[model samples]
Target: MSIPSKEFTGRHMLMTTVAFFTVVIGVNVTMALYASSSWSGLVVENTYVASQEFNRKAAEAKTMAASGVVGKLSFLHGAIHYDIRNRDGSPAAVDEVAANFKRPVGDHEDFHVAFAKVSEGRFEATHRLTSGDWIVEIVSRRDGKVVMHEADRIDTGGSGQ
Candidate 1:
């Protein structure tokens, strides 16, 4: 005897569609929540104010570049080191040095380190960093004015520029 074949119905199509959409929507919602929780979604508090300050900040950077005032940063073991110099290759004297070490994708591992002057134009601080991508920002200020501001990307396990 030949076996009877079952026919596909609208109910089957409906269930298939529902299952596909459910999976799609479920994944999307999961991704959205994860992203929102990990990042604050704001690079600055006020975009308008930051835009207005852009010109001034650029000018300051140019002035520092012209004077050859620059900062060099390095990371090894658990310590961060910096060296600031002027056009004449002399150590640039700054009142303070501070740095922010940020993970590229999350805030949970971000930290700030205050540098102590080790010698003329050199400073060092110990940080707790792991092996990964890091965004490093170093600011040198003299008399409450920024003398040098530099940013770089460094790999914790390798030498960073």
Candidate 2:
């Protein structure tokens, strides 16, 4: 049997070291790219319209608030209202407000889902509406906190308040 030369053994060791360094450098670069692309905290700020620069977003909050809608729409300045009603233009229950918005707006059919609750003689839903046409449907609250549910929706269109 023939034995390999010391030179051959030394060259193999050198190649192995190079391969290890290459892999380590590749992994470090990949990690840096991933870290830069992905953020770990809140991506947007939720401010009331009083501090907004865009007039459109502030207006949308008022329109939805008139209907007693709730959900995250597009918050502009913070003047929200709700004007929810029934098919016969009457009041609905807390579990029947499903607002389907299909207007001259986005390319896709974006909707606003609402669930009303009685506060005095008025009704309030769980969908914050924008300044558009929405067919709100009411839903019931389960064994979860309302805060865990839809707290509010923002109006990303115009400022009405």
Candidate 3:
């Protein structure tokens, strides 16, 4: 028996379309991941807080939110005073930071953040944070790219500082 010419044409067309869609979807996904990784994206990081392990934090936050464990951060210049309020008039919050900075770095705990503390207009991360090259992405409720600062890495290992 011989295969019908129409059957061959229809199968070929369907396969071609499916292949096209697959490639398109793959590229879209890759681009999305890169953009999302950036500081500014769909889910903005207004105060330099990157939700690296969002799912994990979400689960934890959900549980803690009920317990009234609101996240807060503090920016410090000398690891003593709140530098966040020094320059900017706005008060900032430290959401979370690396608990164990001395330990090996992981995909998530890249750095820490303190969120939504409004002493003035500026915001801070966390006190005792694992100091070292932090990306201070400061956005504003008014607009984007308000200002950003990068702080030198410090030791939280309690090395007699």
How does each model score on TM-score?
Answer: 0.66, 0.27, 0.27
Query: How far is each candidate from the true structure, as Cα RMSD in Å?
Result: 6.6, 14.8, 14.2
Candidate 1: Cα lDDT at 133: 76
Query: Model 1 — TM-score against the truth?
Result: 0.66
lDDT of 3: 0.41
Which sections of candidate 2 miss by over 4 Å? Answer: 4-10, 43-161
How well is each residue in 1-161 modelled by candidate 2, as lDDT tens digits? 99966665888989999999999999999999997677432222455543565576456545545645333323224322333343455543343323444433333655554535444214343444445433322233323311112222233446332
Clashes of each: 0, 48, 30
Candidate 3 regions exceeding 4 Å error are: 1-8, 41-80, 83-161
Which should have the higher lDDT, number 1 or number 2? 1
Q: lDDT scores for all predictions?
A: 0.83, 0.43, 0.41
